[model samples]
Target: MGTDVRDETRNATSLLESNLMAAAKDLRNETRKATRTLERNLMAAVNEIYKRITALEQVLGWYRAGNYNLYKVFTERANYTESLENCEKYGARLAVDGIIDATILRDLIDNLINSTDYGTYVGLDDRAKEGTFMWLSGKPLIAGEVRWNSGEPNDDLGGGQDCAYIRAEAWNFDDHYCETKLNYICEKMA
Candidate 1:
């Protein structure tokens, strides 16, 4: 009778262990399925966003550079004030960051533009106070951050060369008259 009781106890323990192991295996399989589904959904969303951006780039002629804003090169020539207004109409502003990237600006010009002798107008100007250049965003344009043209940012005579522009020949800032009509780059800043 004691042997029979001992055999029954052992059988019960073995059954319990087997059930627990099966349950654990089932839980792991379910977790893996959930993770794979989440990964697939994330990839699909990313692809959709990429397609929309590509379509907009083609239609609006807006180009984007590495870690930079989406910019559009307007061939229509306009002076400083007019260019500012034009960018505003499109719900954007001029690329008037304190530090301008001459290489990216040059790539946008050389690759996108066909011809322009008047150069392109940026938002830097000394209009508020003479000899004190500032961006359109009310930030001062640091001299060290810019690649100014050779002997640039100088007014040969009073009220001359107050506005800054990027020359087509090279990607460097050159002071120009505010009224000079030139191509522009309207940047949609992030």
Candidate 2:
């Protein structure tokens, strides 16, 4: 009878051990699945942050000039031709757009000049013929379309005063010698 009782106790203990082992295995599997889900969600959040940073960097690279996004760089006094060349390197050109565009440039240039002796060069020129002003693209300037400083484009200064510049005081267009070194503004498509 004693031996029979011991055999029954051993059998019950073995069955309990088996049940515990299976429960532990199931718990480990569930933990692994939860870990995988957490990793996937974290990676998605990091990727979204990276995309937003890139967009902000692009916006920081440019500046607002009225209705246009422009890149303005201060350079050592350079000839009109040299200024144009420099602008070309950055995929921009000398600022010579419509009247409204030019006006915005004038305001910006005026603020920058602020009692400085140097002025800024624009893309307008009469190189094709004196008194026949035109934008750099060869588009003729309509007489009343653009405002010029009093007694400007007079060609009175001589020495090939044909490149248009912004006068600091009036912020109006005035022809100057192309060879004169000065600061300049560059424009690009927004």
Candidate 3:
């Protein structure tokens, strides 16, 4: 009888140890799953933050490239004489005979055209001689390079007007009275 009792007790102890070990294995598996879930969530949040930062960086780059810098309408409203005075005040001059790239010319056209009823005088004119439209900066106008409207520089009505203006459509040139009170576009050294 004593031997049988000892055997039964040992069997019961062994069974309990096995059950405990199984429970410990289950706990470890659950902990690993939870850790993996937390890591995935953290990585997703980091990626979202990185995308937002990249978009903001692009916007800052555009602002720094002078895309937003433009001439105001008030500066363009003065006539040829007042426009020159205003340009001097603002440390700039009218768009003269200079090597204008596409970007600057596009900006000038978008900003200066159609701000008023009258055409605005640019820094180009043929006041010195006929067929000699020169920039106020003392540069000669090159032939076959002018973007003039059909039948332009007519010196219409017998040569009273000599100043140049970007037409309302911003596609061609027109000569107007230099003393006419119209807006003007000014260019400064960047």
Candidate 4:
């Protein structure tokens, strides 16, 4: 009778051991599956980031090659007259109407204004016709896109203000006497 009881106890212990081993195996399998899934997601994210970086590099390459038009901002303060002289020295001109796009405009606003306190001149002038502004490059001004400061181009002001300068605070334009001293942005043919 004691031998029978011992045999039964051994059988129960063996069954419990088998069940524990099976459970451990199942847990290991699940862990491996989860690890593989995480690896796949990480690889995909890295690949996507690499693709974006490549595309941006291509664009920068084009800019370096002068295949795309770009705006170069100057922080040195100089009047429109001096700005034009400096542009000639660098083989560039103040940005004209055709060059005004959202990208360039935003860049100019952010870079020029955030970096300096002096106003920078753009290539806008109403020298040709009163109330009809035209860029120095002879393109008509697009009405809504231009940045003009309050009470600007009021040519009636005794000071002969004819040129426009970009103010840093709000990217607004203010007409000054063409001879006023201010920094300028030059655009070269790209």
The prediction achieving the highest lDDT against the true structure is 1
Report the poorest 10 consecutive residues by lDDT, candidate 1: 97-106
lDDT of 1 by residue, 1-190 (tens): 9999999999998998999999999999999999999999999999999879868876888777554577777878999889999999988787764226666655666656435665888778888888998988887877686888887777755557788888878767888888889988787775
How far off is residue 134 in model 3, in Å?
A: 0.6
lDDT of 2 by residue, 113-145 (tens): 444466778788888888888887668888776
Query: Over all chains combined, what TM-score does candidate 2 have?
Result: 0.60
**Each candidate: what lDDT?**
0.78, 0.73, 0.67, 0.72
Taking the candidates one at a time, how many backbone clashes does each contain?
A: 0, 0, 2, 3
lDDT of 3 at 64: 13
| Comparison by TM-score, 2 against 4, better one | 2
How many clashing pairs does model 4 include?
A: 3
Runs of candidate 4 with Cα error greater than 4 angstroms are: 1-67, 97-99
Candidate 3's displacement at residue 112, Å, is 4.8
List runs of model 2 lying over 4 Å from the truth: 1-62, 98-103, 110-117, 157-159
Model number with the top TM-score: 1
Positional deviation of residue 93's Cα in model 4 after best superposition, in angstroms: 0.4
Q: Write the per-residue lDDT of candidate 3 for residues 65-181, one digit (tens) a residue.
A: 133332433433666778878877867677653224456555555544444455656788888987688887787777655577788878886877888877766546788878877
Per-residue error at 154 for model 1, in Å?
A: 1.5
Ranking of all candidate structures by their lDDT, best first: 1, 2, 4, 3
